[model samples]
Target: MLIGEVARRSGVSARMLRHYDSLGLVRPTGRTEAGYREYSREDIRRIFHIESLRSLGLSLREVGQALDNPEFAPSELVDDLVERTRERIAGETELLARLRRIGAVGPADWEDVLRIVALLQALGSESVGQRQRAALSSVEDVPVPVEALVEAALNETDPNVAGALRWALARTGDGGLALLAEGLGSPAAEVRKRAVESIARIPNGAATALLQESLTDPDVPVRRSAALALGARGVADAVPTLVEMVVEGTNDVDAADALTVLARDSALAEQIATRLVACLADGTMESSARRRLTQALAEIPGNTASHALADLSHDDDRAVALTATYIAKLRNAQ
Candidate 1:
């Protein structure tokens, strides 16, 4: 076959075939009387082989080495190609996400698009200050897409930046809740915790309902954060986890405070006091746990808490006794 016929059959352009010949990648096996390049069957097969390697993302130089070098091992090269392809895919995926976010915002013009892009860049910046600033201003300045805020919020490690992201997401209303809810199921413990924390900051019925469901999350931190948020919202469902946190001494003070908030209801106050009293009565509880429980009960008003405190005032644990006795007197004095 001549060059044109070879190009037509192999789908390799004539210019490319000539370039390959110049690089000695695939030389013509013969020449006609007019001295035009002519390809033998084997030469056409080599052209097909080069095209096959190129499909696998091989550079021309790599393709030449692969076709010519008998000792060239393809294992390392193939692995490298796989890695490069993965990186390219990841980059393209992120670009698609960025574009989706920008389009979701419905930018009015190039200026609006630029502003959103800047905000996103800042949110993902290497500097903690830049990320923190971006999160803080994203909602107020340019109306960043809530999805971007949720994504940044879930992956943020810096406490201040994460807090700012949560604040921004919360102010964005319940828009980010669905995305944050997905984060609650993330395998990363930190992501789940961040998701809960961000949800906790959104003071709305939808956020409250989500927190209620998260109270049973498999992650302990997730459950605790959900419980704390629910407790603040006066949700009685968090009582069990709040009591557990008190016993475990994990954010026990905040847990106790949350329980106090939930106990403001007259009917719920007695029920809470009863639960705490029951926890104190458990034989398996340590003295420290009993002390924390006693302290928690002291904040609950009414006869149930008073009676429980009076009973605890004489407990065997000296610290529990002192704490309960001191609070009981304060209650009497009031």
Candidate 2:
């Protein structure tokens, strides 16, 4: 077959075949009387082989080495190709996500597009200050895509930056709630905790509902975060987890304050008092846990709470008795 026929049949252009010949990668096996290059069957086979390697992202030099170097191990090359392909795919995926976020902003012009791009870049910047500024500017400057904010919020490790991201997300209303909800199921405990923390800041019914669902999350931080947020939202459903926080002494102070907020309702106050009294009565509770629960109970106002505090004032544990006695006197003075 001649070069043209080879190019037509093998789908390798004649120009590329000549280039390959110049590089000594594939030389035609023979020549015609007119001195035109002629390709033998084996030469065509080599062309197809080169094309096959190229399809796998091999450079021409690498393809030549692969075909000619008998000592070459394809497994190593194949693994390298796999890694390169993965990197390319990751880059493309990131680009697609950026494009989607940019489109979500509905940029009015090139300037708007550039501004959003810059902001998005800043959000992922290595400098914590840049990231924080981006997050703070996201709402005030040009509204950023809520999805971007949620992504930043979940992955952010810096406390100040994370707080800014959550604050920006809260202003986005419930737009990011669904995405944050998905983060609740992340296998990483930190991610789940961040998801709940972000949701906790959004003062909307949807965020509240997500927090309620997160109350049962297996991650203790996630559950505690959700409980405290739900407690502040006046959702009585956080009672059990708040009680547990007091028992475990994890964020027990904030948990107690939330419980006090929830206990504003006369009925909830009684229910909360009863639960606290029950935990106080459990001999399994440590002296410290009993102390925390007693403090939380003292904040609740009702016949049940008042009576429970009164009984606890004379309890056998000196620490509990003394703390309860002090609170009881304060209660009496009120």
Candidate 3:
């Protein structure tokens, strides 16, 4: 259909439709021989999504800015980048405060590694990747859990578990998920759970259908296995099922989060952390969900999270407070 027909069908205005085109927000699929713009079914879908985000208070510039960089890190955009720079510095300080203690300990520094583990357990605000990278960045570093501990980390629901899983993926070459897959047959239920988590985090094409198979399992926990796997992959194929589960499922925080992580259809760990921050303002979520949301948001890089923070700050909700506090703290820390 042409602009008029698309607008009539999609409920978006023709002027707004053209404006979207100029902003690179949407493009015509074809043109009439007369040179008028034309759209296919997919283009109309894009138009509807543009309208929805704009309805959510995103300005044309903000929406376009969002398109320019789908990661939604506030630090990258001029509007919120300044504030984002600040929060990243503070997170580093927090990371280092924990690191200094680990450094004082001798050889294995096992206790310090445990100290960080304990702190992450206690605070629950730390970034899984940050802590994982800290320990794994250079292993003349700290050796908290032996390499063998990877199996145990997966089964645990604690968000910090991702850190341990990241290490196994880095060290194990091609055998990481293969190792996890074997764990499924082990006698321990935790082993099975952990294997599912690791497989979700470091995906293999052959593993997708395996994870999907888990969705219909009788066990509630196992059912969640497929959800998280699909989420970690950020596979668009799972979006419909995920969003449906989002509206109607429980005992599946990890799965729900995996889907939320796919907001822009990306699975990069850094970008996932950035989206977590913006989601803090989600009016649809409960209070506890919002708190966890803030922690994830706080972990984004200074350069990447700044712009996302600014746009989300304008959000007329409670997250603005949490966002502002993080921004101020990070700036002063920097």
TM-score of each: 0.95, 0.96, 0.32
How many clashing residue pairs are found in candidate 3?
18
- lDDT tens digits, residue span 140-175, model 1: 568688889999999999999998888888787888
Query: What is each predicted model's overall lDDT from 0 to 1?
Result: 0.92, 0.91, 0.58
Q: Which wins on TM-score, candidate 1 or candidate 2?
A: 2
Tens digits of lDDT, candidate 3, 275-320: 4544554568765555444444443345445555555555555665
TM-score, model 1 to reference: 0.95
Summarize candidate 2's per-residue lDDT along 91-204 as a digit string, tens digits: 999999999999988988998898999999999999999999999994656769888999999999999999999999988888899999999889999999999999888788
Q: Number of backbone collisions per candidate, in order? A: 0, 0, 18
Stretches of candidate 3 off by over 4 Å are: 1-149, 154-162, 232-244, 249-334
What's model 3's lDDT at 276?
A: 55
